[model samples]
Target chain A: MSSSTKHSKWRYVLLGVTAWLAAFMIPQAAHAEYGDVVINNYADAAGIRPAVFPHWFHRIRFRCKVCHADLGFQFKAGGNKIDMAKIIDGKFCGACHNGEVAWSVENCAMCHSGVPGTPTHFHGSTVQSLIAPAYKPLEGK
Target chain B: MKNKIILTSALALVISGPAFSADGVSAEEVTASAATPEPVVVAQVAGANVFNRNLKKVKVKNAPPPEDGIHDPENEGTYVLQPPLEAYQGLPTSPYGNYVDWVKAIDEKKLQPRWDRIDSSEEAFVMDLDVLREVKASVPDVIFPHRQHTEWLACSNCHPAIFIPQKGANQINMSGILLGQKCGVCHGKVSFPITTKSCKKCHSQPKPEDWTPPLSEATLKNPWR
Candidate 1:
């Protein structure tokens, strides 16, 4: 083959190799898909239930800027330095949980009503009916 | 012509000498040259601050060790500022776009659940049929703490869906979770941050065999309550 033709062929080969290498080296950038905010931190440590913070429910009722921007919640779980004292003092959850806006702090059973892992007595009745109607004994018996 | 050919060969050898020659230069010289690169050698001899540029912006001046000998950053009251819990600002059409906005708007609606009012109750913690079925199908029941979670989160955190006021109505399943539904919602993301093979981390019980506690027991205990 002529030198010019050979050189052109070599150029094509080099271009192919370069393209393959670039494709192999570059990772596909994955975009974040919206979903739940799982909280695996301190759940077992704090003896609390596996905390699953579902984002879908709250979004329908409120806006993103409310809690995250205004209340100062960290995007990541365990990111917030939350303690009971801070909450009772009206920080974090306490800011709104002060009774007027949401459930009153006096209503301990609303959250702390049942044991961890054990269904709350208040809500248990409904769940029991759906899953195990046979498990329920006669009222007085 | 012969001389020209020889010269060309010699030039090529010199250009590619390092590739072919096992000992192109003295080992000691190579080692010394590598150890004393231009930047490091220049800084050492000048006695100038290496991180001067970074220090100026943050105002963090390095000082001699304290007499007490404690080098903890916490003691110096210079802890790293945590990233705020703001909604991710990346995607315009996030499945949780509205949800992220809702959490941000928590302070405005005044709908944030009180830490005290948070249902840390064992009852609330109880895994519903959907959650229990999913756990039992794959592994053991995940010992969840409802009240303890409430302390850390707002009611808007997992209301109306992962859980509903009406029990047994919420459709939580392994499929949905794996698809980022229900508990899987945050397990792999912002919460425990699920992994491909993190079964034991969640499903495993609190027994000693496979137990690994991340936080201190003191922190776990409900001191205030």
Candidate 2:
């Protein structure tokens, strides 16, 4: 085959490959899934891991208006002025967690357990992991 | 060659002059014809846009009025608030199931409210029971006329579930209600669209003074009998 003809054939093959790759990449980019809660406020400021709240779990227990409207929680994270003192005084977490309505705040280490160099283990599993175990089939007969 | 060229030019001018001026056309005629076509196209586009806008408004207006009449099962999906309780069967059970089962089931077309159908109102009355109770402990239990509501609803509309069959069994709380478990199923979405009037709807009762005619008649007739 002539050199020019060979070059043209190779160019067509490259174009085809590029077109195929472009089609495949578009959908993945468009529908990429990301974590719902991105705690950029406290951690980025103090160089530590800020608390990551999973909406999927909390929503199961209570309604959005109960906390948002009734308890005065702001819509955006970091917007609400949450502090340890208020929680202990039964303002935010204390409202329910006074050992009656929900989990108590007596165990400070539950939320603030992280140390500087040691690896921190937040006890509860992710929403997916917690739900997955519940759905497993019963053990063999 | 020069004589032939001159003869051809003279013939062309004579032929064109008569055709160009035959009806004595003016510049205005030429301009008007050119300008006319542009407006017709612009008018057509404008008409199309108006038609689309009107259609959108109509669909939106019609949608919520009917879905709002009955309880909404999920936060998602289109709805209206009409009466006489049409059911939307086959919806999955709400993760939190406090809504009247009839209303919830209606979403799945499983059950229908037993009532006559009526046009839903754009404006809804709000009933805030909390504030009402604070004001008067002896407040009359609001006699919500079920028959009136059924004019636009069905039997399964608020039965066998949303309200427990055993009267007074379902003690609704704010926390449980908000999770779309109990009364929240219909209040926020359908059935009088709960608001400030919610208290009046559920709590307001017929007063003793208001009961003069019927009670007085019975009392006078029987005495001690």
Candidate 3:
């Protein structure tokens, strides 16, 4: 009933809210969504689904230079003007994903999972375990 | 005399007040802030002052009769000359000639004509810039053999200026090239004219289906070599 007690309760409520928001705002290393780069250059506005490029999945297999330097990909996401037209032309992402290389470019939903409720194909506990033992966080004592 | 001095000072302030107020900004600085290029300024000045709007009314001397087809008043007498086919004959039908033969000949001191400075006197080095774009196009894909071009021109002639080195930066197409952009900057003018039915000169290689991604360095090597 006291004013000091009321103020203490208010402070606790504010701290709890702050902690909850921080959990969502800060990027988590273990999560697949952490390094996801949204490529909405022409997709979102044009009614097509924007692509969510998973950096974490690709980084495990290939070096940065393979895509960035050798393939002439701009360092920043969406920096290179990528479109379906150019992709089909065997440029940009199409360089490696041209059916014969890694995966077919025809598989749209594999990358274009930015639409709400769209299930990401790579998000699973089994895939997380496959990320190698070195990348995992240190365990508690 | 005091009134004359005051009037003169007022006139001087009116004449140079903006320049002084601008914190050392010159006339060039004002124009440069707009980021206008020198050629645009020259054109505007020439149109407004030198040539004047009245110049359009004046009749040009020895103007060709209207009956002449394809008369360009701007170029006047200058004509786009077709590159002689004889110049390319006997040269390797393949891009950059036979690289091995040329190198072997060089070692034996029997390389004919040599990689001489015909287009430029400066030292030019061979570089591979073969890019495979438009694989599905009707004709063969382009293998932009730099050795073929570098044999004549310098690196400074194209890099970072005319053609940006970044891949996919320059959207090259036949229409744009014909419009004097990209390759048209020189091809139609100083270099070989594209209209001479020399399409195969560049697009010589066919699209290799099942062509592996991450082009192997072996393919990048001089095909002639």
Measured by lDDT, the strongest candidate is: 3
For A51-71, candidate 3 gives per-residue lDDT tens digits of 656543453334343565446
For B161-196, candidate 3 gives per-residue lDDT tens digits of 678888878778876665557776544322444533
Q: What are the RMSDs of all candidates, in order?
A: 27.3, 22.8, 30.3
* Candidate scoring better on lDDT of 1 and 2: 1
After superposition, the stretches of candidate 1 with alpha carbons farther than 4 Å from their true spots are: A1-141, B1-138, B205-225
Candidate 1 per-residue lDDT, tens place, B1-225, comes to 445645555565578667646666644454444444465343354465445644212111111111111111222221221111333233122122222333223324333432233332212222322233233242555655553344335556677535685645766665656545677645544333344345554565534455453565677796974
Candidate 1 docking class = incorrect
Least well predicted 10-residue stretch by lDDT in candidate 3 chain B: B62-71
Model 1: how far is B216 from its true place, Å? 43
TM-score of 2: 0.25
Q: What TM-score is obtained for chain B in each of the predicted models? A: 0.30, 0.28, 0.39
Per-residue lDDT value at B225 in model 2:
62
Can you rank all candidates by lDDT, best first?
3, 1, 2
**Model 2: per-residue lDDT, tens digit, A1-141?**
899999999999999999878754542111001111323344335554333333323333343434544466543435665666777887865677677775686544233322222221111112222233211211110
Q: Evaluate every candidate with DockQ and list the scores.
A: 0.02, 0.03, 0.01
Docking class of 3: incorrect
DockQ of candidate 1, scored on C-alphas against the true complex (2 decimals) = 0.02
| TM-score for each of the candidates | 0.25, 0.25, 0.27
